[model samples]
Target: MQRDFCDPLGYMGTRGGDVTATMAIVPRIQQVRDCAAAAGLTIIHTREGHRPDLSDLPENKRLKTARAGAEIGSRGPLGRLLLEPRPGEIVIDKPGTGAFYGTDLHHVLATSGIQNLVLVGVTTGVCVTSTAREASDRGLNVLVISDCCAEPDPLEHEMAIRLLQIEGGYIATIASTVDFVASVNTLAQS
Candidate 1:
């Protein structure tokens, strides 16, 4: 099956938001990138859009996000993708936590004949988990890269990863970055 690595809400730098924990996942992200390349897989990177037109979001949410310093279109560094996506790699700007929401990701996956997804990124309990659920509901096999995902609270991150492992009638699988990379390498060799 054609697999894709889905990175959601990977905003880097403190100016964008709390990235201290997320920073630890950068090298793991690079490992995933290398594995994808070797396995001839695709990498789908999603960034949350913070454009000035806050009409799409509720007033409370808009206010909260603004207070958090993540105005999508703001000239701030938060609007930027933490990692530089390679040329030709798919970069999706999403309005919500679920990558499939209000985005062309579904169509892109379908057209690309992608059947499996390996999910990673920041705020594991939020965007990463949300996308995993959405992907499961869509009938795509989902594997979450545990070590490549992070949250501000280590407890929350662990709990979220645990919950995701059995979500939607056991729809998701969790793997560490090292194990995932090894598996990918093995697959390539076979």
Candidate 2:
């Protein structure tokens, strides 16, 4: 999962001030993180933080992206991990939507022998879906915790989930946070 918090664009409801959408998923994200900790699962956090050089991206895109990040005051508390990752939990700074892009996420996952990834974050149609596609391409089994992901548009969120379900002839599983945590608990017990 990537960029779970921050960025007010997707979090605000129809009423400009309402943040129900973002607030709704915070607990679910916490549940998944807590379950993973209880199960001894390694959790990797990814945040979009472009470099000052802006060499990773084209000039046109770089300018707009940097401005948006700055406008949101991402460098302050908003940019920090909402659920501060515990020590030893890997935190990656990604240049793009997919965690694997412009990062050593692939190498880290491979070296750590992680075959299955559980994706949970904001903007299902964007970052979450992009990461899922990338993970599928890299031969990792992907599971997205639907409830833990939020999109400004309900239909867009559903569409993203459907796309992930059958992408590139590979199937990615979708489950609610409750179900996912239950499965993790079962495995831990067994």
Candidate 3:
């Protein structure tokens, strides 16, 4: 679970080019995070950051340029972790759009025996959607808690939802944060 979730302002301080901020999603992510924690689910966090040495990647000069703009290595706005990673929670530093991109996220999930990915995060049009698509492609069940992800603009958020649900080839739903928590609980029981 990400404290930033989908609110780029809180994480990035600036929406960059995005016009509006979805502040509403934060609380839902908090609720889902709490519920998942109580259920003993292994919480994994993926943040948009790159190591200063760029040891995390060895290709794509364009990626280098992009990371430079995002200040992936520096303790910029996005680098400040609002929710500190707790013991047993894996914190993966993702250098690319997809959480699994340029990271050991797949290996981590496989080792942890996570068959389903309850994905909640920011930039609905970008990182969150990309992660869901990749997860689905890899045969991992992915549930994108719709209300739990936000974009800097509402229209983009809505567009992302449509694409993910209609053509992303994943089982997606527009679940509120509370409903997602309930589902996790129910899943744990079953």
Candidate 4:
């Protein structure tokens, strides 16, 4: 999770939104990450950010974030708001809400022969959902772990999962962190 979204005095906090729910999902996400790593599954991280000159930011999105106190390119306690590629992790920087748009994510997936996608991130209704939808559209089987994602508003977080399921369950399969971890562990043992 980016500091801008998770850190108090950062984006969400500056706009008076409680950061409790967002922070609460961190452990579950880490649990998922560990299981996926042990299973030898690829873990790709997606980050939303604009260029230094804000050239890639759309007018509406810029206005929205500015009003909410997350000025593009602004640094938080965790340093820059975007992302840095960690060793052995693929980091995709996205200009828009979804990761695939204007990014090589699709190409990377195809080249790497990845078919199923598991998503875990902050703001379930936004970047995470957007990425799930995009991946589904591209024929990737998507699974979003319920407890591993959070929104500032819990209702939206819950609703986003339902919305994805309403499309005949083609959008994404929603799971809990416990179930996902068990499945991954079983696969690892096999």
What's the lDDT of the predicted structure labeled candidate 2? 0.75
lDDT of 1: 0.74
Candidate of highest TM-score: 4
Q: Which consecutive 10 residues in model 1 have the weakest lDDT in total?
A: 1-10
RMSD (Å) per prediction: 5.4, 3.5, 3.6, 2.0
Highest-lDDT candidate: 4
Tens-digit lDDT track of model 3 for 2-46: 434333454343535442355566667778888989998888888
Query: In what order do the candidates fall by lDDT, top score first?
Result: 4, 2, 1, 3
Candidate 3 deviation (Cα RMSD): 3.6
Residue-by-residue lDDT tens digits, candidate 4, 53-86: 8788788887886676665756555664423445
Q: How much is the lDDT of residue 123 in candidate 3?
A: 77
Which ten contiguous residues of candidate 2 have the minimum total lDDT?
A: 9-18
Off by over 4 Å in 1: 1-18, 50-55, 69-72, 77-79, 167-169
Residue 52 shift from truth in candidate 4, angstroms: 3.1
User: How well is each residue in 1-190 modelled by candidate 1, as lDDT tens digits?
Assistant: 0011122343233434455566678788888887897687998888675345755565676677577665344454223455778887898877788889888999999999998999988779888898988998999999998889987677889999889865453868988888998898888888
User: So what's the TM-score on candidate 4?
Assistant: 0.91
For model 2, the superposed segments whose C-alpha errors exceed 4 Å read 1-19, 66-79, 167-171
| Residue 1, candidate 4: C-alpha displacement in angstroms | 0.9
Total clashing pairs for each candidate:
4, 0, 4, 0
